[model samples]
Target: MIKNFLNKLPKKQVKSAESRDGGSLALSSNASTTSRINSASGARSGNVNSLENNSTQNSGVNHGNKLHDPLRSKANGSSPPVPYEALPGFRDVPSAEKQNLFIRKLSMCCVVFDFTDPTKHLNEKDVKRQTLVELVDYVSSANGKFSDVVLQEIVRVVSTNLFRTLSTQPRENKVLEGLDVEEEEPLMDPAWPHLQIVYEFLLRFVTSPETDAKLAKRYVDHSFILRLLDLFDSEDPREREYLKTVLHRIYGKFMVHRPFIRKTINNIFYRFIFETEKHNGIAELLEILGSIINGFALPLKEEHKLFLVRALIPLHKPKCIPMYHQQLTYSITQFVEKDCKLADTVIRGLLKYWPITNSSKEVMFLGELEEVLEATQPPEFQRCMVPLFRQIGRCMSSSHFQVG
Candidate 1:
């Protein structure tokens, strides 16, 4: 009978009740909290409990209004943006309603402000900042699975904030002939305040127990991974650090994406080696690759061997090797360690790129060769030792004291 009466609530009467009595919505929210409290306490016999139950029973009209808000909004999505003061937060909202509230927050954040001009939307900017913090905390402590809609909302909001075209590099960042990176100031992102929080939220969400890989795969797919890889070029080291960790996490958890990640990174290397010769995150990428190369199975697959020969070895030819030489040396050494037989191939590759004209590069190559030789067994050493000793003789004859 109660169900029949609720089914019979005419839309006009429901709207009229909510329109004339503004307190009904707040009453409904408070009544929900009170009923939850009373039921959890097991207070079944008291008049207070009876009164709470009656109150819950009377809020049906207000509940209908909550249900009606969605339909009305859909009827007019072209409505101007919600005022900054009217934006909702997840705090104190019922757990069951948090998902909807989360969507609203994401929608509001989708409107990217011109962070370059601080004079714009001061209050609104702070509101979004606070909203992002709440979101980060909510994702961190969330106990249940994220709904599909929530996952899409996350990607949309993140894409809006993270995937913009970064400004051009300062002249200080260019590859000057003699200036060290320490001589110049670093280019930091102006919007890092909000960017950092969003990055944190994404990192936690990716690693969260509630994020099922199967569902997450839908939004965090190949195109998503590609765009993320592009972020490795960001001039801001802090943002690239976040990208490095997040991409590493994605590569680890999303098993289906593994092969593609390797291939795409190889493409990045190919471009860096052959085309652009300029990228900010080469060291970070190689850092991630060091961990990955460590995990490669023994008697390695031909594909892995090809990567070592084609990409890792050629990484030595870049003018910027000094920038990433440590990581490059580690990755190359990992390849040789997995199969000592590759030491000969690696030694020959190193010798092929040895710099006679550039004394500093000759010194770096000598250091890398020392580390590689430490892992080289007798058999592989014999294969390349003849030319290797020849290079040592050449280095000893060099006019540069360091090479000698």
Candidate 2:
């Protein structure tokens, strides 16, 4: 009766039933299928049964209830399966189907979850987050050899939503003349973590050796780089840090775009200096520009000289001059080193912005002056000596200092 019942069971359920029964029965019509299933299940169940019996017997003797060799079964033949890369041929030309699937998966990862209704979609949100993390991990490990299609897809998704919560443009006045109302709420998204992941992925993308040229030519445009600069004013320190790294990476990898990056930073500095726009990443941006200036060739371009005069020189006028002092000094020194003739120009610029009331700042200015004087050639120094000593004489006679 039991044999008849087992034989009558559907093929799908038969294997499950056989597993439950320790695979003791031979019920299938195909002899090889029945033999293979029986043998495999018997071995699996035998290991499990031995483990259970050993634990039962050793419960009192072992004191910790420890059984022998938990990995013994896996060692024999039941090892955990290996995970395959979802985007194969990522280093070369991926197949059309794989590319399409990768695009679909990437698009799905961009889905924003409504945190206000987390109760309804908690499970779905978790699954999506995990998928995004895994996908980002895979791409980052590729070392920047992504196909052109993949690079475009990544740039499309990242640019649109990188600053989803924050506006790149200045905030507008929402209140009307006489109406009393509550303040407007900030537009924040719950998926900032995912956004951060994508930013990190982009950092890796730009820094990847194979992808640098591709990114510069195909994906990284002037508008996209400008949008990144606009994000420099983000209130969130974390977002600003990520932006700093990403911008630096872009500057490093895309040599062709370095001029534009400097120009954009110069415009931002113009606003911060002249218009007094509050930008938190000025120090960070200067840090990046310092490296770019270091790499400039001799006989600096007129634009490069103007940047040092207009952008970097005025940077010292801000209250937070100390914050960017090191990077600012390095950039100034780079210019002077590149062309000793610029030494007089830099010193004159420094004297123009030299602090008035703050004695400590005056000392800092003097230190920067000494560096320029040290780097200045004798002939160049002689050219500006009269005006340079005139400024020093004024410093000595100023009311803030008392001569010994």
Candidate 3:
């Protein structure tokens, strides 16, 4: 039947037909539309949907080869710099077919060395670490040819297996037990080079023109970038510094590509500042935010004052803000003079006193009246406060501030 005929056909012939027929090898058409199809066996469908939604589909336009190639060779004897698109050994074999074959081989490697086998990989420690790193590397290089569906499935399998392996490893008892892992030279250290390779692949892929916006969105999705950032501290200083460089390039390239990475960074900043559990972590977080605001403001297009105001509004509400504000108020009142800057900071930080809408003006006016009365000024001041009070009463009666 059809299966027998397909099986009998040459591999190249089958692939050509599959690509032409919009079968397993085909990318979704650039029509900004999607149709559901039940996947064949283990083939993933998610990348098809992702590509259809985020790529040429959403934009409803196809990118032609007409776009100028920045990597193109110059006519004159100009400087010859390496192109990002041209990886080592990528020049001789430029066809998409070759890329696909590379991806398939890497994917098979992950399947062979399963990390989730606790009994085999448990407190075996360094051996397990080295093996898992190799698996991650193999799967991570699957950037160029495999559809998002294929890449996602591979990552899912790798991450789940690695997580299980790491979880089963006996917890280190002494503070310094696992800290000296880098001092010993590796029996192979094959993992290090592979890790760098995979990391580079991911970095390039996410920022590549070939990747659609929808797929690019997944790069920073669910705190993935932050999680990657957290991984740096666990490495040796040199390796950690190298990873930071890679992360810097990734984040920078993302912001340059999409521009919305600033907002993403801002969101991260808010979490670091207002939501993080560790109090000492605040200074480092603030420095990072300050660096972002100062260095990348134009690219970020952030509304600094307005963004702070917006963040403050939620924090002002009593039920919403933490009880720490109340305790801070007490601490400030005990330590600082009545009219001191610390007292002002505490009060301003604690209250969302500014009315969000005109409807709250009456309440604001009442609070103002109490404040003026408490200040207990001279007769002339009292006379000025009285007229202000009358003005507030008139505005309230007339409803001039409200919109219909």
The numbered model that scores best in TM-score is: 1
Candidate 2, residue 187: the lDDT equals: 38
lDDT of each: 0.68, 0.57, 0.32
Winner of 1 and 2 under lDDT: 1
Instruction: Put down candidate 1 lDDT per residue, 199-236, tens digits, no spaces.
Output: 76787788788999899999999988888898888776
lDDT computed for candidate 1: 0.68
User: Each prediction's TM-score against the native?
Assistant: 0.78, 0.64, 0.32
Lowest-lDDT window of 10 residues in candidate 1?
A: 19-28
Clashes of each: 0, 0, 1
lDDT of predicted model 2: 0.57
Model 3 clash pairs are 32-57
Predicted structure with the largest lDDT when compared to the true one: 1
Q: After superposition, how far is residue 15 of candidate 2 from its true place, in Å?
A: 60
Pick by lDDT: 2 or 3, better one? 2
Off by over 4 Å in 1: 1-82, 170-182
Give the runs in model 2 whose Cα sits over 4 Å from its true position: 1-98, 113-124, 143-145, 165-192, 209-216, 397-404
Q: Write the per-residue lDDT of candidate 2 for residues 94-184, one digit (tens) a residue.
A: 5545556667656554443333332343444444445555555555455436777777767765664463445465543332322122354
